[model samples]
Target: MTSSLFEPEPGKDKEASSASMPPALKLSLEMGPLVIFFVANFFGQWLIDHVPLFSSFEKPIFPATALFMIAIISSLATSWILARRVLVMPLVSGVFVLIFGSLTLWLQDATFVKIKPTITSVLFALILFGGLLFKKSLLGYVFDSAFQLDAEGWRKLTFRWAFFFLFLALVNEIIWRNFSDDFWTNFHVLASTIFTFIFLATQMPMIMRHSLEQPPSDKNEDHAD
Candidate 1:
């Protein structure tokens, strides 16, 4: 989506109105699908028993996966409709959901679905690190709409996120390999979300430290002259 959503109008004081994701809207777009997936998985049997709508599926995970896939696609579409473009992160995740989710259903193997997060995380990590190799801070594109940071800040933030994504990938691999399906599912929805938010919170001091000083706009400079 265009960073304009976060940018202030020309005449406004930039410091008074920094670009940012509206918390409620951000949560809805980011967490809404995951919440749906979790609820479907946790209460699959109950849903099948209580609601005739879900009775057609013999297995619980199948229906849950189907609903999860649908929710994710819908969420992405909604974001696009609202923002007039797709955010890179969600767009990438949505593509993986379509690919692996289809495989999971077609092959009737939860393995595909289970590995989706790992694959997504690893891919993102690689992309971030790869950009750094070429002297690009691609993560800035992802967050620029919501934050104003100097070049150094973007570089540091990108490096930290690259490592973070790698860490998440490793954790997902370990969990899904050793844990039960239910446990892994819960981890994906609950634990991962919590950990991600905590990590983001921990980075606040760095973000503030690296925030770019608001420069005088051309109009303001002209007025001053």
Candidate 2:
């Protein structure tokens, strides 16, 4: 009935304590919603059809919405426990999930749920790009605590990610609007994961190239300074 979650793993274990935390931990935490969504969808029918607390969630729509809410809360709790604060992007996504998921269930239309990822992606792109427009590296706020990238490297990485998320948004909109639920679901999980992993892999060269060539403590910043 309960599960003990392992503490959030650090992204760069090599310099584990040097960095605030790991990007991988943030990535894994972000997956919390998707994992909950998929699991809830998969077993929804069985529960609503048999169980009582979920009896009110007899409909697929309600169960899906309920799961979104539960996932958001759980994600916030996890982040609070690990980082002692709620992350911005996850909080943003959670708000959208609660809002749109509620609309989908209330309207008995799945379109709202289907568009959740698209909306999330687009919003992320906007936020990232907007920061760049003002010559601000907002990614620093999210990733600074994780891996330390040089200023130029952080700028380039943020811009690339902004565009990448926009592209993903377009792809999600196209697929969900045109394809069957089974097709969308399968591609959402499998294809998306593969694409993301490959994208992260492709960034290795940039990461290595921009890494703090030496420890960033006093003597190092002073030498560079």
Candidate 3:
């Protein structure tokens, strides 16, 4: 069966699958790969020295990218086994990880992996804006079950998210170019998560303001009275 990335599965609401997944487990699964990436980057040589399999990687980043690719695959597989389906957000990220991680390994250059986040962010922004051009609020496919909102609300939220994605892309470009690889690695995992949480929190007020949960019957009753 065909499925849209942002669309919920048949016979299930958008929130159903998400609700069934425990918050802590979901958080761990999502963060696990980045943690692996960070640790591998830092301690790769020790692993290379001790683990014969990793010895061929001349630099830490190479093995780190390889380990990261493995970690992302493992994470995606585990997520599918546990949740019965992969989350679109992480699935998209995993795809980029595999693609750029492979390039990093095959080309023996770190630039591909380093720019993965920036490219992913830009791609997401493009998807969001493209949805708008079609007169569709595709973000609603991802979030409608959680936040009941009118069309206008979805449009506003989608526009905000698209811009936020662009901002993320810019931040990633600036950091990776200006900072040390280690520092950029740290920022990749930590700063992005913090910024995303802050952005989501900031959107709550607007979401509440446009909520569509009140029953139409209630409105009709009030009008009759």
Q: Count the backbone clashes (under 3 Å) in each candidate.
A: 0, 1, 0
lDDT of 3 by residue, 34-59 (tens): 99998998997888898888887777
- Tens digits of lDDT, candidate 2, 33-55: 77766667677787688777678
Off by over 4 Å in 1: 1-23, 50-58, 213-225
- Per-candidate TM-scores read 0.81, 0.78, 0.82
Ranking by TM-score: 3, 1, 2
Candidate 3, residue 111: Cα displacement in angstroms equals 0.3
Where does candidate 2 clash, by residue pair? 11-22
How does residue 137 of candidate 3 score in lDDT? 74
Compared with the true structure, model 1 gives a TM-score of: 0.81
* Root-mean-square deviation (CA) per prediction: 7.3, 7.3, 4.9
State which candidate has the highest lDDT.
Answer: 3
Candidate 1: Cα lDDT at 145 = 49
Q: Report every candidate's CA lDDT.
A: 0.76, 0.71, 0.79
> Which of candidates 2 and 3 is the stronger one according to TM-score?
3
